[model samples]
Target: MNLKKHILALTLLVSNFIFSQNTYVFLGSYNLDKSAESIQVYQLNTKNGNLNKITGVKNIINPSYLTVSPNGKYIYACTDTKTPNAGSVSSFEFNPENKTLTFLNKQTSGGENPVYVSVHKNGKWLVNANYTEGSVSVHPLLENGTIDSTAQNFQYTDGSVHKERQTRSHVHSAIFSPDFDYLFLPDLGADKIRCYQFDEKQKKPLTEAKVAFTKTNLEAGPRHFTFHPNQKFGYCIEEMAGSISVYKYKNGTLQKIQRINTHSDEIKEGFASSDIHISPDGKFLYASNRGKENNIAIFAIDKKGLLKNVGYQSTLGDHPRIFALDETGKFLIATNVNSGNVIVFQRNPKTGLLKKTGNEIQMENVSCVQIKKIKP
Candidate 1:
């Protein structure tokens, strides 16, 4: 109750309150086949791991994957088309004051069924991956946050071991290296991770990487990829074979070092594995499995860039397509596409384990989850 002590405490309380009022999260969904809102918003409680719905952005359909600009002033979504061989990417200007997204424009994805979209680090380019047509496209971004013309579209023409799913090329993910100097495109149908050197200065942003590409198991369908915090190693999750492939990365060359199973026990064929992400501290890695077992598998990362299976956690829903950690690494949210809900879990940073927070959002066909920190 001293005069100076009370003033200092009051200032700290006000600063903390201001920070709490500025955190938000965005959810993207596949609302075409279900009765749910599209592009919903939630406010994140900084003190506790809970989410509160703020508002929902309407008029967008099948925004399966979402990305935010480097400056956090724009939002990009893969707005998929129902018609076969048609896909597009949409950009919107975000108003942080009101947490409203204003649609800017859409650009043809240059391929079919775009499953992923990302904004380049330079803030001048956008990248998208079309799954059905097995092509990766790069588009230019206007200064006003709208999309310009597509700069390049490269198609992959090859098949792997699977007869049903690998009969043709299927590009699943396009991820940039930690340094932003290279692009890694994982092809499910081809069972390969194609590497391309990404130079923003060139007329064509992408060229064949120095090492070209690396092949996974014969029938392994690679779905997603992630890089370690040290930038010395890379990890990729195989969708068809339910495994993880770790590689040593240097100067655009990937040398496979180890391959491990995401699942503890081998199940029958036709199971699916999804997203992969490394913890911010690079101490742990996580992967999602759907099909038979709907769970998130956890792994511990050793000092030499290897994964040790820790355990698994049930997602509490079916078809866990995607999940994301908050910017602070305090919570993890998993989006179950088929079950139409998203669940939240509090993180134990020391142990790299997750505990269910018992918070869930009932979204229709939730496809993607993104965490956006609001400005003060």
Candidate 2:
């Protein structure tokens, strides 16, 4: 009986090890030269939030933002290879068997300084937001995952309150609604969230919605927008004001439900909140504050889809521009662009708080972080 008990315990341990999922960490950076390593991949150990370097690639200049394909076989990045004023979007193929990324092809991003890129769920269309030129660029995806040339482009010339920053439209991020019926452009310079109807079947996929745009608070500088997993609520991070606007989402329309400050009231000026993301379970929300705070503000979601301030965690570095949570919501990785460090934190599922795991890596000018779980 003693031997049988020992064998049962050993079998259970082996089964658990075999069933664990493999998590991959992808980082995009703004490297000055094309020869230096700009995009790096790592394998993350979920048990302790440690990252093991898999492979690093170069030859692409300033691949600042990255997004994985829905099927997890490719990655799309916003970069500028030739001239800073004429940015481009590049594609790469990921091999899970050997854990490597190979450069595919790139195309012009329709405007200058493409800041964000996202792929459709069906993997047929790609969209990017141009920051400097204030435009939206659309591309068709070839069967082999390469991006075709730009098919359509929309330019925005309106401005808002700030004399310098908001003098013209600055399209910061392009995000698709949960149902994929519409695309939302958070224009930092325009102080508005522009809505467009998306039809994948058509060559020109974006059309002006009935409600062309929704006005945000003057000088809010909306940076990034994300929807809750429940798909009933959405959140936008206001960069200039350092606040979040919660909304009721339906049929590509956003009705503001509540607005909350991302930082402590006592700590007032120099607010530059960069990115916002919610837990996969829809119980918690995390937003990164860059300029003065350099910390992540944590919030808990109530039954009414409202947010309550829970706590804050220092990112262990400076200028936390972007951070991402793993699919399982167990680990949150924060990347600092100026300090050039990546820190991983283990999250508590019940309390929605993050604790540093003492696992970190250093890379210069790292602007984006993306986590994916590759299937076997």
Candidate 3:
């Protein structure tokens, strides 16, 4: 081999090795003051399941939820939460090499209390769900990591059985299907999962699907929706009912296959289930419960796309509003919103079990957790 060519090849190998050893973790929280830091960054040691603090960004109010762009160069967050008619979505440019986020721009969320934000696979569209106003907003994403003005907005006013919690529509989450051709929005107050067809090429990419929506149990209150890795099944977590509904998905249509309770039989009232996620290998599913049980329910996935309850793991703190599994499925991070702690658990891939690693961080009101493995 030539001298210069050999040296260049060796440098590339070393760079790849370094990138494989670490992943980046982004945290979002509710800030007491507008000037306080609402977002934090950490470097995760993939080998040992430990996190090292990187930096924190301030001046953005209530960045309670965050999503990274497909290319991992940009982050979009729902901001100004709980502020009447002042909800907004902000964009930031992320530099993975330095583990920093630079604020780019912000746009109105079209409603109040924007709770969830999701980016399409093509990285050209962004969507958010407003809880208080029960609306969904869509925007065009520019190549420079800044978000354009809202291109479309939809509002709903229907309510369900619950007198207090379901008095009106409460759109909690906006999630895209695995193929990026459909969007499923879980409405907590309406007890419905609204379906939409998406085409990035169109001026208005979001439209109602043929089957408009799927109704859940009378007072289920679906909060978050997620698709299985196989793309044939979908899961929705019910906040009020404390149950997880399994659905068969096809062509943007959802058919309820199963509805199972997420809480134990000992507890009856105050059911508040929060988030749901499947392992990368598609062998297990995990859901978080907040209200009386601060634990995660683990289920084993059968070949027919059904869930069998395996066991429950304590979150090691209270109010586990959100949790995320690392890309490699080696670690799971759970954020306790009420207890103000972040706990890391070592995952057993074969058995789908989680064990506490004694690795935890303290941060008040931490509500969201996201992990991304960046490549050089």
Clash number for every model?
0, 0, 0
Candidate 2, residue 8: how far the Cα is off, in Å: 6.5
Q: Report the lDDT tens digits of candidate 1 across residue range 3-69.
A: 9899999999999877775677778888674344688878887667678877767777788899888
My TM-score estimates for the predictions, one after another, are 0.96, 0.96, 0.95
Give the per-residue lDDT digits (tens) of candidate 3, residues 191-291: 99998999999989998999889999988999998889999999999999999999988899888889898998898888999999999999999999997
**Ten contiguous residues minimizing lDDT sum, candidate 3:** 13-22
Model 2 error, position 152 (Å): 1.4
Query: Tens digits of per-residue lDDT for model 2 on 234-346?
Result: 99999999999999999999999999999878777878999999999999999999977899999999978899999999999999999999998999999999999999999
Better of 2 and 3 by lDDT: 2
- State candidate 3's TM-score: 0.95
Please list the residue runs of candidate 3 whose C-alpha ends up more than 4 Å from where it truly belongs after superposition: 1-17
**Any idea how many clashes model 2 has?**
0
In model 2, which regions exceed 4 Å deviation? 1-15, 18-21, 81-83
Best by the lDDT measure: 2
